[model samples]
Target: MATYISKNLISGEEIVLTAKNHWLNFFSKDWLAYCLSSNEYVITNKRIVVKEGIISRRIVEINLSKIESVTVNQGVFGRLLGCGSFTIIGSGGTRETFRNIDNPVKIKRAFQELVS
Candidate 1:
């Protein structure tokens, strides 16, 4: 009954993802546990790097199973432009939020593929 988790890949297996959530860029185990349990993920360099404005401080990775739900949030203005945000809920331990994204439909489809 929980959502959100983080993890790392090791020897063809994935380890849990942990963070302090104290200062961006810096990371430590803030919670008790974290894991991206599913095998579904997105791998778009330009998307998370340039378009998303995320730094290389961490790798471009996310666990599809850890995701609770995918939401496309369009602000009043964003709804007009058709560009918006992505809200992902992981197990009980982790959460990821992305903004000003494009082609959310494709992303949703990817998640569907993982579950189906």
Candidate 2:
């Protein structure tokens, strides 16, 4: 299936990186719900896009110029498992957190490369 990002890309925009929820999510209390819902984080040359849910959907898109900061948080287990959470803070003070994501540091780095 075509990704939410692909269908929405504008001229000159290309995806830099894409990340999904980590395998560790299977052990969480919301495992079943997590499995039912899909979470995606996509970074492009011009923006960051997050798509969540299955039957229902929640999408958040932030232009690179409007991003203030990206923060990664990991516990010992998460560090060992290569999964964690990243928070994106927008210029308008909007904060969005995506948790249990694989290689969150890589996502942060990808975003840094685009905005820097």
Candidate 3:
């Protein structure tokens, strides 16, 4: 299926990595909402994009040059399950966190490679 990220890419931009919420998210406190909506994390050659919700949508984009750091948080179960949360901090005090996402480390590493 075509995603919000794919439809909005700028000229010469290409997707580098994509991640979705892990199955463990179904056990989260927001399980009902999680089931009803979808969340997507995407890294492109030029930026990071997060798309949330199924019907009513929220999209956040941060330029690669603006990203300052990426941090991952994982518990015992998360480590075993290969799912964790990623916190991305960008210039101008922009901070966003994606929870229960699969392969958080891979996502972080991809972003780091793009910016570095």
Candidate 4:
């Protein structure tokens, strides 16, 4: 069976479809309550992007309730191929990013629509 999690952008609520493993990981990681935010389109997670001088190697975590807006990032390859990543802004000026998901444009759009 295949499972999916269409999380609520506002409440950090989620609906699981198939895979329970990742879903559990999301909770233990505090991904739902911490890194997500509601948007008219898609949710954004913080970018654990390797900064120039950050030296702590911890597992990336995100709060799904803090997202202020969803910003899509795409290169020529991403745009041409119809995929990309997103950035999210959250409460107290926090942020996150989820990279390289399938059909990001469509997913974001779906999320935006659903949330709306």
Candidate 5:
């Protein structure tokens, strides 16, 4: 999904940052398919947005104020490569996982700073 966040952006909302899918995704058996599946994360002034999917469409939005916690998991290789999965937990126990995302630490920090 080649989405132009700028075009879809709501009035008064601006993207503070953007992230792409991790390089580790290349290791999957169906690497081509993985590439076709666009996985991106966008951080705006008021919310965190994740757009991803292959067959069906999926979009997740979490208001910064409602974010309870953010967790990152990196295996040995993942840590060395600086790519991994992260889970964003919202207030009321809602959770969303973005796997094989690039620069997870930086992404987590951005979210944490905004949420705090």
Candidate 6:
């Protein structure tokens, strides 16, 4: 399914990549947890954004220029299913992680290509 950005983007900021929360997010027996864990990651020309929350809303936006590194953590199960968690380190030592996302390698590559 295609996820569209809810907020207005910059004049030239175009979406380069998009990822939905992994199927594992829905594995919880608790329906509330499953619903709350649903999220989307969008990579644009200028930034990476994560939209998440349950009742109240939370949006995390990281400028591409401030990203110092991107790392993907793939465990045995993750590798087997081709899904992993991604960590992004920013210039000020700030960090964020997106768990159980798809095609982590491609996501990391997209970040590197956009930042450079």
lDDT leader: 2
Cα lDDT, all candidates: 0.40, 0.89, 0.87, 0.40, 0.81, 0.80
Q: Locate the minimum summed-lDDT window of 10 residues in model 6.
A: 29-38
Task: Report how far residue 90 has shifted in candidate 3, in Å.
Answer: 0.9
lDDT of 3: 0.87
Steric clashes per prediction: 7, 0, 0, 25, 0, 0
* Candidate 2 C-alpha error for residue 84, in Å: 0.6
Q: What is candidate 4's CA lDDT for residue 101?
A: 39
List runs of model 5 lying over 4 Å from the truth.
1-4
Model 4: residues >4 Å from true position, as ranges?
Answer: 1-65
Question: Candidate 5, residue 99: CA error in Å?
Answer: 0.7
**TM-scores of the models, in the given order?**
0.46, 0.91, 0.90, 0.44, 0.86, 0.85
Is 1 or 6 the stronger prediction by lDDT? Answer: 6
| Candidates, ranked, TM-score | 2, 3, 5, 6, 1, 4
- Report how far residue 17 has shifted in candidate 5, in Å: 1.5
Deviating ranges (above 4 Å) for candidate 1: 1-56
The pairs that clash in candidate 6 are none
Better of 3 and 6 by TM-score: 3
* Per-residue lDDT over 1-116 for candidate 1, one digit per residue giving the tens place of the 0 to 100 score: 32121232334443222122112112223221112221123432112111112222233344555567767676776556555656666678555766544445455555565555
Cα lDDT for residue 99, candidate 2? 89
lDDT of 2 by residue, 23-107 (tens): 8888887576468646778999999999987777889999999999999999999999999999999987999998899999999
Task: List model 4 lDDT by residue over 3-35, tens digit each.
Answer: 112332235444311111112223444344223
Clashing residue pairs found in predicted model 3: none
Across 38-116, the per-residue lDDT of candidate 5 in tens digits comes to 6658999888888776666688988888888889999998899888988999999999998888888998888867766
